[model samples]
Target: MEHLKTFLLKRFRIKDLGDLKYFLGIEFSRSKKGIFMSQRKYALDILQDSGLLGACLDNFPMEQNLKLTPTDGALLHDPTKYRRLVGRLIYLTVTRPDIAYSVRTLSEFMHQPRKPHWDTALRILKYVKGTPGQGLLFPASNNLALKAFCDSDWGGCRATRRSVTGYCVFLGNALISWKSKKQTNVSRSSAEAEYRAMANTCLELTWLRYILQDLKVLQTVPVPLFCDNQAALYIAANPVFHERTKHIEIDCHIVREKLQAGMISPSYVPTRFQLADVFTKALGKDQFVTLRDKLGLHDIHSPT
Candidate 1:
């Protein structure tokens, strides 16, 4: 990586190693095309543990635009099963970004899972059962461009009236990080929620830049952060203080600072192409597949 050379020139000395085969349960393979990482063995073990190794494959991870509420189901007599599945799903999200939101939704009910929560958790397991070989594909490229996508669903959590936020970071076309979670406080408007999500995304971007720098990979250009909300982009580009925008947090201002310093820039993207949408809520089969492909996830065994 040219970036790595650029970064390493200033930092600690380093040595080149040969191709990587495995690390931390994730296996890697390299060819002229690119490097591939997957947790096939781990996925299979999880399915076998849950007794769904031979189950039929699911067409989608979750129901189309599925919504889960805090009070929608009866309390479970035992929560041990639900908790175990949730824990595994969390780790799986490291490679299966498609199920991040659903896993986050299920984890919320860990304290006192209900029937519906348990059912949803099982649905996720069933989905995982079918795709043990699916993983991220990092095609060989000349550049490791950094970019981010962020999205939020206003008042998505029915119980708290708090919005759900999600974002994904990509190095070149390969996904490196992502998240799906709820906002701490209720946002008065959709723009406010979008702003908060952008701020979170900004923090992630900042940290990632540092990591790459530490690894001797330096980004040559400003990271473009994509969002579906125009208001959020406007707020990031402007620097006016108003009472109505007082709730706008200090963290949110970091976006402007990054922009001004040529570290990061905010850009608008259509909701249809917003990759982070997958992390904010469930979607229909067609849309989900589209975003998943965009994120560079494909079945390694599939004939290309």
Candidate 2:
């Protein structure tokens, strides 16, 4: 590391910056255990900007089973505030996957945010207030095996009736990538929605594998891809296609191609053990907390 710095210093006008304590808005702390990353300062700035620094705290980011449509309430008179807040919240999801689903939902109303939408956005801020220092931890471990959990909420969107895809990828015990996104086409069944999600996860895992290979981390075994839907697993493992899967032929091809190439191994996991559930829907406090802990989120500033 020092040699590279010396070579760069000879040509480029760059200072050593010492260590990676802060970069962009992310703050990092290192110890023997591993590294902990958070955007506490940025989170507080958001709360203060929204005039919610002193607001009451919320236990969770969004209400369970709370569905917000584009026309849920009266449109905002001035949408600049709503748009700006949601934009910032989107960036905050970098180290805070706990709010990914809420931010994704709130982002849909950027064009014409309603009063309920604005209120829901502020509620996410309240949840942030409760644990500003909460963030992801990369434990000091040598395990490089990759595993992922993918899930989908069938016809979750009340406005468009589109399914939502949620997935999380882990490099060993540490989470490396995650997403909560709505599907473009409406799925005909829960199995199709889940299969689409599996395809998405396969793409991510494939990309991560290339990245790991570039970093000289070769994966010896096929990465495990967990899903709660039995039908989806069968579809991926089965080479023969059925009439019901014709609509999603492209998605089926992608997952099956990867599975055949030994890039991923699809497996079944129960709904309760599906860590990606928190991203697919607004879960209750108990489930949310349990999954959050499983994701390795911790508040460094909170009392131990």
lDDT of 2 by residue, 168-235 (tens): 99998899999999999999999999999999999999999999999999998999999999999999
Runs of candidate 2 exceeding 4 Å displacement: none
Q: lDDT score of model 2?
A: 0.94
* Model 1 clash number: 1
| Number of the top TM-score candidate | 2
**Best model per lDDT:** 2
Q: What is the TM-score of candidate 1?
A: 0.89
- Runs with alpha carbons beyond 4 Å of true place in candidate 1: 1-19
Clashes of 2: 0
**Minimal lDDT window, size 10, model 1:** 13-22
